[model samples]
Target: MSASNNTADREAKLQRNPHGDFNAVEKSRPEFEEDVEFHYTRTKDIEWVPGSGATSDDWKKHKKIAVDPYAEGRDPLNNYKLLIAGIVPRPIGFVSTESKAGIRNLAPFSYTTFVHHDPPIFCIGFASSVAAAKDTLANIMETGELTINIISEWFVEAANYTATNAPPEISEWDVSGLTPLASEKVKPPHVGESAFSVEAKLVTHHEWISKVTGKANGTLVIVEGVNFHIREDATNESFTTLDPKILKPISRLGGITYGRTTQAFEMLRPSWADEEKREEVKKILEK
Candidate 1:
């Protein structure tokens, strides 16, 4: 064999089993390269490339998989795994809460999102523990306060460390080696290292039973933001929009996998009032 063939053979042999433990795995660069980097002026740059658009005919020709989510006999575990994996990426809410006794707790939750902004509401979901309620959920219920920290690349490992399973008495903050700052609006402290942190007062919570487990295993807590703290280095002049390059936020993928926000593209929304779009739609209507 040629030298290149031998090298490829060795690489093939070194490929780790997908089921193998995390301790043994060969790291490699991402599949995409500079060729796939997002063009900032994406809409405007279309002029540079001919046939850049995907037409209705092109879309209709592609085959797809259809899933019946409410099927009577679907395996719940498989469904959950598929959902988590299929949802390309999800933001992590590095949550901080304090117990009635004042001991701190920290954990990363991916099942979280902004529910409302007028009341400045944020929602984070929790799964129950077999022996008791989740520490963070219990604390929020008792104290009606919590802090949310945005995970950045600078301290993602430390944020992940806080997710380890431990007794409620034991503080994850101590284990993470990340400092905390006393909150102005809430009793819980915000993560000192996080680029963005929010002090929220618990508005209310909804409890629900899990379909698979048939237990009261889910709790959705809604909190109204009282104060927001953003690192000056990561914010713009007005502190409205954040700079991704500086924030370097990390996101959750499927099990044990994390995603990095390394590239972005933009496309302006086409207004229906525009003459060209109106004419095009008119032509389609006539057809």
Candidate 2:
């Protein structure tokens, strides 16, 4: 074979089996070159020492500091601040009821949520305070009827005023300076300022144990909606809709924070559509 032809064949063989020479391969690929050594500094020596005269009781000293800041007070404002700050975006239940003596009572509760739709039932958690429970729960227990006025942003302030401590006989409608409108199904006058209200009957009552006092606390009354009152603009031919943007429902948050529904979005899901999308993804992955 020609010298140039032989040289080309040798180069191809060497390229294919470059590790044929172990010493040459070791020289070309240095062991230390596989990993780099970065410059580092050690500032202090870390040594293990047993106990160092520290007692386990030292941890007990921090117990007071670790306690919940809210557990220290009995003030309603403080309790409200903690509840409002922690239980975020709570639905507002503006309840209206009448006493056996024909006195009107209207109040607001953030610890309220819808329970069932078939029977249209909802519940409100009220504390056994002289201010809140006296007129509302006391009256409901007496008359067995109530009207839950769903509050919007416009009337949130008036609803909040109803939470203020007041005399048992004193009506919050008068105290908050809001007019009362007559209801068809119940005697309790609905808040004229509210956008919507539902007359309900006291269907059930549930009692819970208090964590703070370790005693049986007040009851949570389940109310069933009977008649509903919606504003003309909110009611349509097919359904009564209260737009969150227009109604601006106010909600409770953890601490003393209040949330207002300023925006809303909708999502629709069909079983067949979702299944088709899943099958399409599976086919693409298989390919």
Alpha-carbon local distance difference test for all models: 0.77, 0.69
Please report, as a residue range, the 10-residue window in candidate 1 with the lowest summed lDDT: 32-41
Could you give candidate 1's per-residue lDDT for residues 1-287 as a string of tens digits? Answer: 43334435534553423556644443444443334322243443554322335433566777998888657887555566677778868889888999989889999999887888798999987755322456788888889999999998779889989977677899999988999899998999999999899999888878877676576656788899999999998898887887787777889988668887877777557665674455555665576
Error of 1 at 82 (Å): 1.3
For candidate 1, the TM-score is 0.80
lDDT of 2 by residue, 1-287 (tens): 43334435544543433356856876886453313222334422323122223434567667543435446565434544555666678888888888888878788877788899889998988655322245788788778898887787666777888876566688888888888898898888888877778888989777766566665545688889998888767667865476554455677766434675644434335465465566554565577
Clashes counted in candidate 1 amount to 0
Error of 1 at 11 (Å): 33
Work out the TM-score per prediction: 0.80, 0.65
- Which runs in model 2 stand beyond 4 Å of their true positions? 1-83, 129-133, 270-273, 276-287
